[model samples]
Target: MNILLTGGTGYIGSHTAVALGQSGHEVTLLDNLSNSDTAVIDRIAQIIGKRPSFVHGDVRDTALVRELIKVHSIDAVVHFAGLKAVGESVAHPVDYYANNVQGTVSLLQAMQAESVKSLIFSSSATVYGVPQYLPYDEDHPTRAINPYGRTKLHVEEILHDVAQSDASWRVACLRYFNPVGAHESGLIGESPRGIPNNLMPFIAQVAIGMRSELQVFGDDYPTPDGTGVRDYIHVMDLAEGHVAALDYLNGRPGWSAINLGTGQGYSVLEVMQAFERANGCAIPYAIAPRRSGDLAAYYASAEQAHKLLGWSAKRSLDEMCASTWRYYQTGV
Candidate 1:
C-alpha cells in the first residue's frame, strides 16, 4: 500500500515510516520542518534501506496536499502534522487552533476532493482532559482543558462527523499517551527544536551534560511518590501501533478511537530513577509547583487496541530509557 504520512519527519512519524517501510509498504513523507529536521530522512533511509519521498510543505496547504495525494497515488493517510506542546498551546491558542484544527480541516478537504477516505489520525489522550476515571477508554468523555488538547478534540469531532456522514470513511483515531524512547538503532529519535517540553528528552539532555539538574514538577500530587504519574509508551511501540492500525483499517469501514499505551502509569520520580538506572547516572532534581491542567495520574485501558489491532506496548521503562540515552549519546 502507498501511504502518505503528514509530519513524517517528526519523532513518532519517522518511527512509523520505518515500520511501514519494513512491512513492505511505500511511504511518502509530508513535512514543513517546523519541529523536525530534514536530515532525518537520511537517517530513516539508513535504518530502512530506502528513503521515503518527502514533501516540504504545511498541512494547511490544501492545494499542495491534494496535489501530493494525486501525484503519489496515495492509498491512505496517517495524519501527524500539528502543534503539540500543551503549555505552548495554552499561551498561543490561536496558533494551535490554526495549525491543528484548521490544518486538519484542510487535509480532510483535500482527501474528500480526491475521493480518498481511509485515514489514521494522530489523536491524543489529552482529549480526555482531567480524567473522570483512571485507565481512560475510548468511551471516556472528551473535556480537553487546554488549547492543545482542545485542538485534538476538535479534530476528533471533525473526523467523527465526517465518518457519520459518509459510511465509506475508514478512520482510526489512535489516542496516544506520553510517547518516549527512540529507535534501537540510535540513528533517529525525538529532537525538539528548543528547550525540551517533555520529560524524557529533558532527562536525556541532562544526562548528556547539555543541561543541569532536572525539575520535578509538583511532588505534592496524589501518587506514590507524590508526583504526577503518566503512561509513557515507547516510540517504537507507538510506531508499530500505527502499522497495526493501518492493517486493521484495510477494507474496514467505520470510525473508531483506540487507546495506544502500556496501561501502566509511572511517576516522575520513578522515571528519573529508571533513567538513572538505564544511563548509570543520577538525575539531580528540584520539585516545582504543578503546572495548571496537569493530572495526577492517567493511562489507557489498551484492551480495545489489542482486541482490534492485535497491538500492545512491549517495551519496559528501562528499555525506553536505554534506547533514548543511546540516541542522545549518538547524536542525530
Candidate 2:
C-alpha cells in the first residue's frame, strides 16, 4: 500500500515512515519543515535503505494534497502535521486551529475528492484532557482544556461526523500518550526546533550538556514522588502502532479510537532515575511550581489496543532513555 504521512519528517512521522517502509509499503512524506529539519529525510534514508518520496508543502493546501494523492496513488493518509506546543497553542489558538484542525479538514476533503477514505490519525492523549479516571480508555470523557488538545478533539469530532456520513470511511484515531525515545539505530528521533516541550527531550538535553538542569514540575503532586506521573511510549512502539492501525483499516470499515501506551505510569523522578540508570549519566534538576493543567497521575488501558490492533508498547523506560541518549550523542 502507498501511504502519505502529513508531518512525515517530524518525530513520530519519521519513525512511522520507517515502519511503513519496513512493512513493505510505499511511503511519501509531506512536510513544511516548520518544527522539523529537511536533513531528517537523509537520516530516514539512512535507516530505511532508500529515500521515500518527500513533498515540501502544507496539508492545508487542498489542491496540493489532492495532487500528491493522485500522483502517488495514495491508498491512505496518516495525518501528523500540526502545531503541537501546548503553551504556544494557548497563546496562539488561531495558529493551532489553522494548522491542526484546518489542515486535517483539508486533507479529508482532498481524500474525499480523490476517493481515498482510509486514514490513520495522529491524535493525542491530551484530547482526554483532565483524567476523569485512572487509566484512560476510549470510553473516557473528552473535554480538552487546552487549545492544543482541543484542536485534536475538534479533528476527532470532524472525523466522527465524516465517518457517520460515509460507511466506506475507515478511520483510526490513535490517542497517543507521551511519545518518547528514538529509533534503536539512533539515526532518526525527536529533534524539537527550539526548547523542548516534552519531558524526555528536556531531560535528554540536560544529560547531553546542551541544557543545564531539568525542572521537576510541582513536586507536591499527590503521586508517590510528589510529582506528576504519565504514560511514556517509545517512538518505535508508537510507529508500529501506526502500522497496526493501517492494517486494521484494510477491511475494517468503522471508526476506532485506540490508545498507544505501555499501560504503565512513571513519575517525573522515576524517569530521571531511569535515564540515569540507562545512560549512566546523572540528570541535574530542580523542582518548580507545577504547570497549569497538569494532572497528578494518568496512563492508558492498553487492552483495547491489544484487542483491536494486536499492538502494545513493548519497550522499557531503560530502552527509551538509552536510545534517546544514543541519538543525542551519535545522531547526525
**TM-score list, all predictions:** 0.99, 0.99
> Could you give candidate 2's per-residue lDDT for residues 258-328 as a string of tens digits?
99999999999999999999899989999899898788998999999999888988999999999999999
The 10-residue segment with the lowest total lDDT in model 1: 284-293
- Quote the lDDT for 100 in model 2: 93
Q: Assess candidate 1 and give its TM-score to the true structure.
A: 0.99
Question: Which residue pairs clash in candidate 1?
Answer: none
Runs with alpha carbons beyond 4 Å of true place in candidate 1:
none
For each candidate, the alpha-carbon lDDT, in order, equals: 0.94, 0.93
Candidate 2 ranges with C-alpha deviation above 4 Å: none
- Top lDDT prediction, candidate number: 1
